[model samples]
Target: MNATHTPITAEAVTRVQAHYENVKKLGHWTSDRRFEVRARRGMAVLDLRSPQIPDGDIDVEVDLDHAMVKLLVPQDAHIDHWDLRYTGRGRVKDWTGENGEGRRIRVTGEIRHGEIRVHRGGVATLSAMFSREFVQDVRRARREGTEPTVADPARSS
Candidate 1:
């Protein structure tokens, strides 16, 4: 009798904190399936379109207070923020709240006087481009004599 074995990966969690400032994670960095974000009077941007991300569901726990959190996902990704607990003007801005055939991201935790914005596909790319990391990537690419990973030359001014 042959028994099929399902490989198991360590459930590593990435944490991001922004207090009165902005914190962003972009580009081809290694990613875990779980995340924790804490923002107070600031903003946090997370890019989940990297190739290093593993398959299956993703989990994000957020704690916001008068802050904003942005998620940049792939075109095919599905976002689920129904489990989030919000108060005051806190809200999750996902136009389509239905599940899709792509990867699922389950969001939980609480938001107080803040917002969570979700951007997919072209919008996500545009959002990523409007950041300091994009400029740094362009400069690094120039120094290395390689094309910038985040920006396209044909679309540049």
Candidate 2:
């Protein structure tokens, strides 16, 4: 969205970060992963919840300036906002799992002039947040070219 003249890097497939200043998408399915985001002045959206990694611990590290990082976490994830320094506000809105052996999402990083918000929900709830058009866009991109997409976030695009 920043549209800055930054050559896009090969988007990470699994256990990688969804960086800024590039084209990226989190597919319909996700797995246990560690997503790192680094940006200077743009927004980063990291969706850690997906079909495969429905309920598990996720590692996230974000470094940004004048940018926002929004993470979509699963409802069962127990989030830990550790060692996270930021000039703006960062918060995690979630609840403990019923069985107490639920997922955990650990977020660590530093940010300035922007906020990092972690929102939690179930599979149905998270899926609803995205539109069918979003999935279609990925399919189209794959057909058109090797445009990086989150078709299967676990697999390198």
Q: Which candidate number would show the highest TM-score if scored against the true structure?
A: 1
Off by over 4 Å in 1: 1-10, 96-99, 151-157
RMSD of each: 5.3, 10.7
Expressed as tens digits, the lDDT of each residue in 1-157 for candidate 1 is 1132123367888999999999888776546878999999999988877666777777889999999999887767777787999888888886555456677787899999999998877888888888888999989989999777553222332
Off by over 4 Å in 2: 1-24, 29-32, 54-56, 88-101, 122-157
Model 1 poorest ten-residue lDDT run: 1-10
Give each model's whole-structure lDDT: 0.80, 0.55
User: Model 2, residue 102: what's the lDDT?
Assistant: 49
Residue 148 Cα positional deviation in candidate 1, in Å, after optimal superposition: 2.6
Which residue pairs in candidate 1 have backbone atoms (N, alpha carbon, C) closer than 3 angstroms, thus clashing?
none
Residue pairs with clashing backbones, model 2? 17-36, 27-150
Report the lDDT tens digits of candidate 2 across residue range 41-128.
Answer: 6665666655565333566777767666666655555666767786765444333323223456666788776666655554423533
